[model samples]
Target: MTGAPAMTDSLLAVWHAYRLPILVAVSIFFVTLRVYTQSQSRPKTAASSSVPVSPRGQSPEKSQKLDAPAEKPIAPQNPTTKEIFKPAPKSVKPASGPKRVQGKKKPAKTIGGRRPSNEDNDNGPPVSFIQPIVFFASLTTTTERYANAFFPPQLHDISYIDFDDFFTTVPPSSSPDTRYVYCILIPTYNIDTVLSTFLGHLDETHNDFRIDTAPLANLAGYSVFGFGDKEEWPTEEQGFCSQAKEVDRWMAKLTGRKRVYPLGMGDVKSDAENALKDWTEGLLDIFGDILEYGGLGEGVRGSGDAMESDEEDVEDEDESQSGKKKSSTMVDLEDIKMNGDSAAPLPVDFTTVGKAVTVTETAKEMVPKTSPTYTALTKQGYSIVGSHSGVKICRWTKSALRGRGSCYKYSFYGIKSHLCMEATPSLSCSNKCIFCWRHGTNPVGTTWRWKVDEPELIFNGVKEGHYKKIKMLRGVPGVRAERFAEAMRIRHCALSLVGEPIFYPHINRFLEMLHNERISSFLVCNAQHPDQLEALYRVTQLYVSIDASNRESLRKIDRPLHRDFWERFQRCMDILREKRSYQRTVFRLTLVNGFNVDDEVQGYANLVEKALPGLVEIKGVTFCGTSTSAGAGLTMKNVPFYEEVAAFCVALNAELERRGLHYGIAAEHAHSCCILIASDRFKVNGKWHTRIDYQRFFELLEREKADGTPFIPEDYMMETEEWAYFGKGGFNPDDERWFRKNAKPRPTHLIPAEAQAQVDAHVQAQDS
Candidate 1:
């Protein structure tokens, strides 16, 4: 009985241990089942309540709209805890409140105004005179309305006050009582203070004078004048002054009244006293007998008899004033005087400017001097010296057609001095092309020798020579007196006046010296002197005369001196590529018909691609001077028609685009010449049109000396006047016949008769 009891107790202990493990297992299973049922059934509950179920793969966070009725089933309640855990079936509530989709959200509201269209932005500002005046900050709507009323079109002939030129000081009682009304309009920074001071002065005035002051808008038939320094006026004040809405509203208020005349004191550069004196005189001229001791309402002291006497006095005063005004109008003579003080007599023995200058010696020594005959003429007084180098200088004289067009005739200076030197300073070049306008001389040597004359001596000699030339031309007929005076003023230097300056060994140093003297140098080179070109100092402009298209054609047309000239030409182009720091490298292509016209476009494009010059001047080859060798046939016949030339430029632009280059024609002389710009930067309407900044052209030149590569893109090297010349290529050729029929032979009126004749002959030949 004791053994049985012990076994039973052991069995009971084992049963108790296993009972706890089994209970735990059962609790875990029920919990797992409850979680699984809740997850699956929650979505069913949502579906039964008319909520769209999310797709199987979609996250619950992403709410999607119900496109079609979903076929989800309602979850059954758990059987074990039906009463405790079961959800009561949802009862359909009566339609109440606002109906809303389960997950859809309302869109946000747009603030401010709707977006503006492109056209609205493009039409930015209105086009009106008042608008521009406001834009310049010269007048505000506050003042503009007064100006319009005072200067109304209906009162055009009526005398009005010119406050800008009037009221020098308080008038004396003895002064003639002319009917003139002096209206002084002042725009003071301290308006209130100035007005108070003016009122005090008026209050202290005698019975002979009267004064009145009114707000700008109410001041009808009154003159207006602005007084404020541009620097003094802050940007905010200027903006307020230029408000168009304010101006228009003011004008509307003064609809019937005479508008106030507006003027500014800043326009004239004179002391306040002088400006006031001038303004008073102008008022006297406008009003004759109406001026009185007091205001306009006061009767004249002197009656009709006084009018006659006053008229005589007025006429005399008017004459004196006119003479003084004319004298004042003359340009300041001191400004015209040569700025340089280094003047010296010529070394030659010949007296009188004309006899002292001679080109015969220079012509003979051309190979040594590497200077043209024109330079010698300038030294002899046949031309005026404006700018100079050791071997060359530019001379200018007034045109016989006084001030009608470009009235300066240019010539070369210093050729005679270099020629007289015995060291053989001249370097002769070959290639007497038909386009050349200089005297054709035989070629001599390939190199230069001797130390050239100093630049100072050349300048002085040129200047003296120029004065002498004008004195000689003074007696000549058809010359205006003004032109003769203008001939004495030398302004510009053209280094490439006649021949290739590159041949001179001292050419580089000469250019450097010219630059130092503030003389702009324009050097033209014939590709023959590639070596010399390589060693050249980049001047204001470096022009290469591209006269032919292909090597064979160039040989035939250019008649080069060296057999390897073509190779040297290409080499020169390559050198130009290396000297990209030079901002004004220009490839001047002389266009000729029946020669290389057909291929010139392509040839120019290729060369431009290689050289990447800053500009390209495609001009007609002038048939003047020695070029008369070709005469009427080659000279006249080889000129391209303006239309054809324009077309060719268009095609060239197209080619430039194909090569990934950006180019535009800068200038056009119609049938004569067209300039193309290749720089990445250019200007239009006072704004930059390209990536290149022309303002930085000089700056880049300074910076680029250390690194010769062009900071600008290579492709933007050839810009042509395609739009102006061809007009997108659809216009009728005869639409504008003026250029072909009546256009001037050349755009430059300063070109000599011989040059003009050559250009005319070329154009006529092309037309024929």
Candidate 2:
């Protein structure tokens, strides 16, 4: 059975291989037939659903025909290859009928009354980018008469605009609506006749342009022409010429237009009428051309051209009468004369008659309606007019004035003057310090509302203001006429006067006015307004009133505007560091008896290391002004013993040396005021040298003018403590007892034994 089964298996295996091939072929045929049958029987399904169409709108057959081309297979497009043939989109034809209306049109939006667009930004009105020009006219008593003649109030009012206003007003208005032409007219000449005639012409042509003819004041947007005989000029008249030349130079510097033409009858050789015609023609021709080119307006060109041309025609008449003429046209002179009705006497109330009084009641009685105090206070809406120029004037009481008595002080420039003026006229502070000398009633506004008074008035008022009180101190020796004159000129403004003058918006302008007038300023600040301080280009001496041991103490003493007062103070310290290159900055530390005295040595040393000021004044607090409260609280004495203060200073000096700093005691005056100087540049030969240049120093001082800082005259020398007080004391050279009583013996430990021996030997040799 096994053999039979084996043979059957072999046969089955062979048969299975052959049958498998046949079975595969039959199955493939049946599957192919079934697929073919299914494909033939089944209806074709679209790749996507067909969209529905309306039968009423179009016939089904037409729609089918229209869609038949879409049913055909579309060939894939290759963007890289160009198409051989492409069908264009079918254009839709509108029905032959009128179009339907949709909506109403909207109005366009506007910006500032003009259409809004990027073009609006391009054509927007221009902003004024011009910096105001400052013209400083040096006016003295000798020049005042000429000024009064040249610029009469009725003829022209130039006093209303300041130097800055003049500079800013030079460029004419761009707006077409404004008709006025602002012009500054400065006439510089030796002949009164020529000036008189010009004034006449100005009055006749007043409708053409607004004329500002104030002497020493600037006119804006106006052409300035000078008038001079060129033959007869005064010695003081040279200054006027120089000033005119300066103005011309400034104009040239600004506009890059150097050539200037003069208009006067003096230059022409014809009758006054003929000269006037020529002058008027030339003016009209030039101005008419300018106006045609849109360079000037009819307001500036009108009768100004005719009047100016008329002067040229009359030049010959001026030359004919040159030698014999006492003055110009009699009619012109008469035009300025006050009319009989117009010449009504100035009211007695308007006259500046008496001297300022000490007592408030007395002062009120003598005060003129024209007084600065009266005008300013009235404008400020304060009916309470007192003796002071401002409320702070009360601080300059008889006692306060007497306590801080006058002394013969010399400027670095060798100009001798008494330290008379006590308080600054403007009193608005940026820093509300605990130790300020200003009274509570002082005006705290940040700008000067009233016009600045003439220096002469300020000087006279001070003298009349403090007459008897100053005379009482005549007992003090070494007082001289020169000193008294200097005292009268004592408009010395202490920067720390009452408030922070730096905060005044017009501080720079005010200082510029003072500087031009040769007024010295000493600006002192508590280093609160760093912006104002940094803006300072000059000052006699920049004083940083440091009254603290640290940032905490600074905040406590100086209630500053910023929360980061300490940081600002440090920035001020850094600024002072730069001053070493051009300024003589003084870092003043008001040493209270018990408050900051203990930590002063280290604190001052740190400041010295940072700032490296020209002088470091370490002084005891004077129990004056608002300091009385702090003084009483701290039990501070006004006059601390000089020896004791000297010792403390000496110790501080030694400590400074150890830290690589060299210092010397500069002065020990009334209140133990010891000025310590960094001895890096100071030598023993009496020659004072500094890293900064003198010109730079002057420039720096000039920059500080607005701060109301009194300048240490260019000739004043900083006195050493020995020369200032000790050497001039009662301790006579002949009296050994007196010398021993006053002078503090040097500490032996401070000098090595060998060094002492050498000094002793040297002294012995010198004696021999």
Task: Give lDDT: candidate 2, residue 465.
Answer: 45
What TM value does model 2 have? Answer: 0.38
Write model 1 residue lDDT over 1-768, tens digit each, in one string.
Answer: 899999999999998778544543454355436534553532211101111111111111121222322332332232221211222221112121112112111111222443222122221221110000111111122222222322211111001111111111211111121111224334332221112222222222211122211111111123334433344444435632222222222222221111222232432122333333343333322221111111111112111111213443375478788866322323355555565773432233111111122223333222223232333333432342222222322221222223222210110111111111111112244454645543232222233322345545554664465455456656755556755555555433455544356665456665555544444555677887776788776565577888776785675466554546788889989988877663457777777666667656777789888988766666566655322233212445566555555556656766776898766544444423443444444544432232222234445555666587555532232223232322232222322322235655554444335544544453354336
Local distance difference test, per candidate?
A: 0.38, 0.38
Query: What's the true lDDT of residue 563 in model 2?
Result: 39
TM-scores vs. true structure, each candidate:
0.38, 0.38
lDDT minimum window of 10 residues, candidate 1: 127-136
